[model samples]
Target: MIRVLEPPRLAAHRREPLLNVPPVITVLAAAMLLIQLVRDWVDVETGIEILALFAFIPARYDPSVLADGVLPGGVAADAWTFITYAFLHGGWAHVGLNLLWMLAFGTPVARRFGVLRFLSFFAFTAAAGAGLHLVTHEGELVPMIGASAAVSGFMAAALRFMFADGGRAWRPGVAEQAVHAPAPPLMDVMRDRRVIGFVVVWFVINLAFGLGEPAGLVDGSIAWQAHMGGFLAGLLAFPLFDPIRRRPGSDSYSRTSRF
Candidate 1:
């Protein structure tokens, strides 16, 4: 089927600064959780306990493996938890804010990097976040969950895309970019300080929230660790997934991140 492009979804053209990928996913991710929250709230007694289910920790699935470490001591639960926790939410507000940030930054980065690249970055960063948590809360059963790792990856990708070479040049059509056309309304506001500032604030808030959440709440959420892991992973891995880039004169910018 020949898929028609949605004007707003395009990310290749330098029309403005549309957040094509990450932000949209962020919005969608949060929306799904929100719906679940409402449903659970309506029937509190039988809706599967919001706090535990929404959090994404593997132990929540069986509770019998709570005492085990992620790999050395427990079942293969850790393998799945590494990725599954990403979808789990904590509260309505928690998911809501995370989605907001994801949309705020993810879309633009996706626009620049394309879909597959974004997904790769998201997955790796998520794993990294879990890895960090595993190190700190290895034995206590923190039940770590959420998109903080992926979201932080977006931030890292954005930094690389925007700052690597004065932020003016961009690679178009690296992946099968469906939405590559220009959307002036969306693009125009992207470069504004307000948006950039918001991203910075997003990081700060995550750091603060990580400090206050209860122990064993989402694997003892060390939000900073997730954020840090994601950011670093994005920076290092962008070249692999960020479609090959070529300089204006050097024939092509190496898609590989040698710099």
Candidate 2:
């Protein structure tokens, strides 16, 4: 009896893990959560003291306020607050919201920039956000705290490469390749309709928050200006942080991984 040859068995497809977050992202998230936990555990006076030392209060820069010595940490707090404010949050809701966005946007950025560059970029954006906030609300007594600015920065930076190569849809096993793909020139990115739409929507939402807070339409005072500052900084300064090199005489970049 002649036996027919059997077709080769296909290998079983490996399932993708539910949470594919990078270690740096996890660390950053944990740090923010831990800080919030400490804030929650502390007494009212200590909590206020924590905000005084860590939160970014525009009035900290005012000569008059500095003279009064109302804020703690003196000269050093003024310097550190720009970066430290990013770690503080208004409440659990605030921290949770920031982490959700951070996880969404920070994942690809951490993957692309690696730990050091990503941290540097984060600090840069956070400080940039604080700087703009200082300018807009100079001498304002209210303290600004949250990671929204850095999260906004990551969202902006992600746009640079996420929409490249015809804007491939994010799918398991393909996200790594898409994120690693060559980032197109900024001008080309601006020209893309998808990018334009995203920018428009982002700005509009921020504008709404800015307008709504004054009108009592919004519950909390969102730092929309800081968000804009971070977004713009990320969009313009992305090249400075980007690890992938652009090919000469070409609009597209090379796939050489610097991380």
Give the candidate number with the greatest lDDT: 2
Write model 2 residue lDDT over 217-238, tens digit each, in one string: 2225888888988999999999
The CA lDDT of each predicted structure is 0.54, 0.80
- For residue 44, what is the lDDT in candidate 2? 85
Q: Write the per-residue lDDT of candidate 1 for residues 113-153, one digit (tens) a residue.
A: 55666666667888887666556544443455567788778
Worst 10 residues of 1 by lDDT: 177-186
* Residue range with the least summed lDDT across 10 consecutive positions in model 2: 1-10
TM-score for candidate 1, residues paired by index? 0.60
lDDT of 2 at 239: 89
What's the lDDT of the predicted structure labeled candidate 2? 0.80
